[model samples]
Target: MSSTTTEVLQRKPRNVAVNTNPEHGLHLVESDVPEPGPKDCLVHVRATGICGSDVHFWKHGKIGDMIVVGENGLGHESAGIVIKTGSEVTRFKPDVVFFSTPPYDGTLRRYHVHPEAWLHALPDRLSYEEGSLLEPLSVALAGIDRSNLRLGSALVICGAGPIGLVTLLAAHAAGAAPIVITDMDENRLQVAKKLLPRVRTVKVAREDAAKDLGTRIIETLGTEAELVLECTGVESSIQAGIYATRFGGSVFVIGVGKDFQNIPFMHLSSKEIDLRFQYRYHDTYPKAINLVNEGLIDLKPLVTHRYKLDDGVDAFATASTPGARAIKVQILDD
Candidate 1:
C-alpha cells in the first residue's frame, strides 16, 4: 500500500520543495508540513540524492508517459530522521528514516508522512548521504542477482553511469572476473577506471554501438562476456549488450527505457542468449545496508555534487545539464 502526504498538508510551517512542470523547468514551491495518520510516521528529510529519472522529469517533465500533470516534486533516493509516529505505528520510532519507491510526492521537501511498512532504520555505520544511495545500489544488486553470475564469470557492463558503476563493484564482490565496462562519456569511463583499475574500459564510438562493441570487447577482454549488464536506456547500448554477451549467457537489461525499442531478436535467438530485465528492486534493503556496513560496496565516491535544500534551482540545473560530469547530486536539508 502507498500514499502521499501532499494531500493532507497542514497550514503551518512552510515546507520548501522543488517542483517540475512541463513548461516551467524546476522551481521552488511551498507547502504545509504534513501530519501522519495512524500507522504513518512524519519524516524530517535530511539528504536526498538526485536521480537520473529526477533529471529527466526536470528537463522534459516526464519519463515516457508518467508526466507531471500539475505540480510535482522530484526526488526518491533519500534518507532522513523520523520526527514523529502515529498511535498505530509499531515498527518505527524517533530516529533515522528509510526511503520508499515512486508514485508518491517524493522526498525533495523538508517533511514527509509515510507508512511505517515502507520505512527501514538507517544503520549507524551509514550517513544520511550514504543511506540515500541504497536506492540505486538496490537497483544494481537486483540486476546482478537476476543475472545469476558465478565465480570467475566474465562480466561486461554497458553504460558507466551510476547504475553501471555500482554493478561493476557488486560484480567484483560477487566474484566476477576481468570485468569490462563501456560508455560514450570519457569522464564517466575515467571514473570507472579509477574506481576499478584492473577492469577493462571501452569508449563506444558515435556510430552503431552493436556493430562495433563486439569487436572491441573481444579485442580488449579476449572473449565475449558470460553476463552483460545493460544499465543505459539508450537503444544502441542495449544492442551492444546483446552483441557482447557470449552464447548461452545472459543479457540483463537494468535501465529504464522508452515504451518501445527495436532490437535484433534473431541474433538473440541464434546465440541462445538469455535476455533478462530488472525493475526497481525487491527484498534488497537489508542486504544493501549490510553490504555497505561491511565495506563490500563503496557508494560514497559516486556522490560528485552536493547542494543545500535552499539551492534547489542551482542543484537541479547542475543535475539536468548534459555531460556535467556529475554522477550523483545530493541535497542536504537546511
Candidate 2:
C-alpha cells in the first residue's frame, strides 16, 4: 500500500449519517474505514447532496418496498476522491475525483467503499458539489430523452423543485423553448424565474382543480405544451400536465408519488397523449458531465445551503423544512 493511502486509512474515521429508525431519526455514527474489494475503490467522500428520496427514507424509513429495517446510510448524490483502488481495478487510481450513486449504504460518510464500475471521473472544472448534482441532472436528462423534446418545443414542467429546475436547465439546453414551470411555493417559482428569465412561472394553490390549473397554464403559455414534464408526483399535478399537453404529445412522469393515483383516463384517451414514466436514470453521467463541462448548464445556483459533515442532522432538518427555501443542501467533508 502507498503511504498516502495508508495515511488516509489511519487518519480518517468513517463518520456515517445513518437512518437508525423513524423514531430515533438520523444520527452520526463512527465506524472503521472499510477496505476495497477486488472490484471496489475506497473513496474519501467530499460532498454529498441531500435528495428528496433521502428525506423520504429519513422520515418514513421506506420508499415503496425498499425499506430501511436497521441502520442505513442515506445519500446517493455524492462526489469524492479515490484514495485506494482494489487489486483488480484498472479504470481508476488514487486521487481521481469521481461521482457515484450507491444503493442504500450511501456516500454520506468520510470514507466509502464503492464499485469501480459505478464511479464516473469528475472533471477538474466541476466542483465536488457540482459533481454530486450530476445524479439529479441524469434524472432530468432521462426525462427529456423520453419526452422527445425538440427545438422550439413548448414545455410545461409541473413542480419547480430541484428535479424540475434541473429538467428546465436540461430542456432549455436541448432547445425546448417557451417553458413554463408550476409550483405551489412562490419562492421556488422565483428561483426558477431567476434561472431562466424567459421561462414562465405559475403559482398554483393546493386546492386548485387540475383542469382549471391546466387551462391557466395554456393561457400563460398561449398554447398547449408539446411536452409536459411532471416532476411532481401529486395527482393534481399529473392531471394538470395531462390537460396542458397537446394532442399526441407526451407527459413524462419523473417524480415518485403514491402507489396509486386517480387519472382522467377518458380525457387522456380522447387526447391520444402518450404517458411515460422515469425509472431513475441510465447512461446519463457522461452526458450530464459534458453538458456542465461545455458550460451549457449551470448547476452552481442550485446549491442554496451547505453544512459540514458533522452537522448532517441539521442539514437534513434544513432540507426537509419548507421555510428554509433550500433548493439543494450539501454536506461537505472538512
Error of 2 at 196 (Å): 0.7
Candidate 1 segments exceeding 4 Å error: 1-13, 93-103
lDDT of each: 0.81, 0.86
In model 1, residue pairs whose N, Cα or C atoms come closer than 3 Å (at least 3 residues apart or on different chains), thus clashing, are: none
Task: Provide the lowest-lDDT 10-residue window in model 2.
Answer: 94-103
TM-score for all models, in order of appearance: 0.92, 0.95
Highest TM-score model number: 2
Over 230-270, each residue of candidate 1 has an lDDT whose tens digit, in order, gives 99887888888888878898988998788799888999999
Q: What is the lDDT of residue 293 in candidate 2?
A: 90
